[model samples]
Target: MGQSFFDEQRDQSLVKAAIVAKYFDAWSRVMIANAARGIRISRLAYIDLFAGPGRYKDGAKSTPLMVLERAIADEALSKLLVPMFNDADPENVASLQSCLDSLPGKERLKNAPLILCSEVGKDAESMFTRARNCPTFSFIDPFGYKGLSRGIIQSVIKNWGCDCVFFFNYSRINAGINNDSVRHHMDALFGSERISRMRAALIDQLPHEREVFVLEELAQALKELGAEYMLPFRFRRPDGSRTSHALVFVTKNPLGYRIMKDIMAGESSTEDQGVPSFEYSPADARCPLLFSLNRPLDTLAGELLSRFSGRTMSMKSIFESHHVGTPFIERNYKAVLGQMEVQGKIVANPPAQSRPMRKGERTFSEKTMVTFPSRAA
Candidate 1:
């Protein structure tokens, strides 16, 4: 028999909770900063449709409580906070309320004029429709995949400048997409009956490739909903046998994308010194996961070389063009540029200097000129 939905919550992964908390905290900081600069953002609303009992049996806080605490800690966010937590189970709703009532900093949150509520229901479409008017951050994390409908997601995003982070269980899709009942759900989730074509195309492909194709299809569907930028983080079972799911983020704002990329990179539990990557290990796993803080310098360097070979451009031009929402962050470009200089593949030029910079170190600024070397010398 399949695991019970409540049992799934009780057995939640710490790595997943950590990732979600880090991203939401970082995103909140970015939005608060933007508002401080007079961006006129009215409010920061957060809605979690499948919010579990706010705390798991293992004592780790779930996404709903984590987000609420992050907002309460930040004064700017606390003042503009409008949050709603919902679950299909009334018991879970009551548990969430108890968790909220017991949270620290009640005095501060009470003074902030927060608009918060918990509903005992599974009415995600109605809740999403109501969230369409503000600068919202919605979390749609459902076990398996039944509660999230594509039409509701599309309408919410198309109507406002909101951001969403949710899970796409391609493993479930791979198992069920061929079944008639499951195919009906897939069509509703993709907002199209064209999944038959996708299934036909993936029939002879490798398993991993089939997952990739499914993810691409999902990303494309999200793009059609007016999401200008989308990012996906793949997750696997603790044993690393097969991909369990992928966490996807969608937003129309470049800053939102940038912030999320940084958060994802930093929070990734990879030990490599070059590019940041993440892999999940269950709480009961034999081996503990290592968390590292490496930037994607190697990947960024290669991407820069590939895109700018034989071309000269200022740092401002390069950053504006590439760093707005890619895996290569602008802050890490200095390190990448330094590595490129060491390899003689590119030259970072100071203002008004045409000579290739071959010094002890080059500090990249907006005025710095970067040229991809054309000659071997």
Candidate 2:
């Protein structure tokens, strides 16, 4: 990003930073909590390869600074968190170092924040592909798709507790698909054979359809590499024209996936009849319509009814089992299940009172399991 982007910290970028920082806090806490309970976690690392100037020109802190500050705030986190910030640009590195130097109580962190001025390409990929000594939370944000590759993502999240969040420049990569000059970069990104197929498949497709196809292709490839859970938070252009980029979160743990989905959903601009768009549109600006009568939940309800026709599970279990590749969050599931219980479509019980829910406790919480009607019923 340029100084201009840092000038005011664009709304969309701010949203992106918020999602990452929130997830980092939540994820790191889980690790620390588990270790407190005797789980083995010797160290934790937060790596940002394309770390920009730590503080924006307008005085707001970006991801790198925000992360370090959080570590500084918590004693337990300070003991376990090791943050590394790297940028290919010398100017950014210099600025970021200055900011890091000025951070109050910087030495409280386990490791002095490691700031590097290095390109994120072959050498970096090679380094990350090897076995990691500690569980790391990596954030890969590039101005463009130049330095990012599949191997880096695969390697970062291949371990026991490692997770990755990367900026996917859809607009740029889509345009560069057939451009011969950047073909090598494209090959590195999607693999040579996959890129070829993408070019052929994208022929005569509409812009939006092509965008969906490309995102899915990348997600599918990541899954093939064993990154089981992936969630995307999309950003629209300043003019609200089309998708400009997205922050894609990859993880192997269901808990991590659930955490990110909630954070991203909270950052979303609008909810359609209670279902979030999973997008940040500058035009939307977090505003709600005065009145919305649409019942998109009807569609979700039907899908759930069909899938669980004769089944039963905890709301939490149902969520983990169902919401991998879908946009529906946990709240969405609870809302649908609650409605189904009321309308006699299915039975949602808290597993103890009212017959289950303890006389008056009727919330569809994570522990509350629900039973669906049999096909014969």
Candidate 3:
């Protein structure tokens, strides 16, 4: 029997959405961070190359659409003069249209534009052209490697120099690499005689290591297309058993690299050290939530620390400086403070009372001073 259009492949679909959401969350936090730094993005565009049905059949979260909505609702993002969205699938287009229709007001969506395309390969370039002058973000989440052609990607990045997050299916590609019949297809996708070179490089490596070669080749391809910094993040199932997906971020800007590093570092820190197997349960896992939750806090905390380096920073000062809400500040405050304390990088002092202390009077308030460590030490 031929494969169904809606295959019951829960693992791949769920993992892909989860990973895409992670990058979306990272993008949100980075936008917030940029705003805090007074970096104004007059316009921003989000393009999803292989946008799915917008919602999952398994009740798993919607990714590119959800991400777009979240960003649009964010006050920081709303200030942008333009925000555009694009998707390839007809079902997805209907889904997004329905979603947009349900919004309370059309005025709220005036600046938020969306386009649905029947043919992605032919239309992606034109969409990018429309968003050429803006700082754009394109999410390329294809089932296989075919949805995004080299020429299409080259055109988008060349015109917009946009930041991109791509889902590369290394497992599928690796599985087909040794087949004699598919060599031409692989050559078209990879756009090089370097397939032979890549195969040679992977011959001596382990099965797992071969995946890394695919990722590296993809990264190299993006770099050749003008993305200055490329970072690949691997995502596994909740039980940590096997790598389910790889999220690759390509950016021409230094700040994108900084944000990606912070997000990756946070993910690493939250990961359980010395775990026996990569096998992970979708439930009761930290890494899955790490990408969604802790990564933002990690990025925010790092930014806050960098801004206040060599200076005493109060809790209020930190919150104000970062433009973060009180709840977020409270939840992550101690974690950042604790991390700084462990490194002996911050000092805490009790605030003195203005009046004389009585038996029931609170004599001091908790305050913290953060400072960078001396190089000689």
TM-score against native, each model = 0.79, 0.89, 0.61
Clashes of each: 0, 4, 11
Clashing pairs in 2: 352-356, 353-356, 353-357, 353-358
Clash pairs of candidate 1? none
Identify the candidate with maximal lDDT: 2
Please, what are the lDDT tens digits per residue for candidate 3 over residues 1-377? 11221243565456455555665566656765775798765666667665655566665545655665665566666655344445545666777667666644445544665556544554555676777776667777533434456666665565433677776555566776777766655665566566777877877888667766777787776777776766666655445555556677777665555455445434432332211121223543444553343345456556655667667656656644553211232325545665555555665454223423546543322254444433332
Off by over 4 Å in 1: 1-12, 107-122, 142-147, 271-273, 278-303, 323-332, 351-367, 374-377
What C-alpha lDDT do the candidate models reach, one value each? 0.66, 0.78, 0.56
Give the distance in Å from residue 70's predicted Cα in candidate 3 to where it truly belongs.
2.8
User: Judged by lDDT against the true structure, how good is candidate 2?
Assistant: 0.78
Q: Per-prediction RMSD in angstroms?
A: 5.2, 3.2, 8.7
Q: Please, what are the lDDT tens digits per residue for candidate 1 over residues 88-116?
A: 66677778778888888855653332222
Give model 2's TM-score versus the native structure: 0.89
Give model 2 RMSD, 1 decimal.
3.2
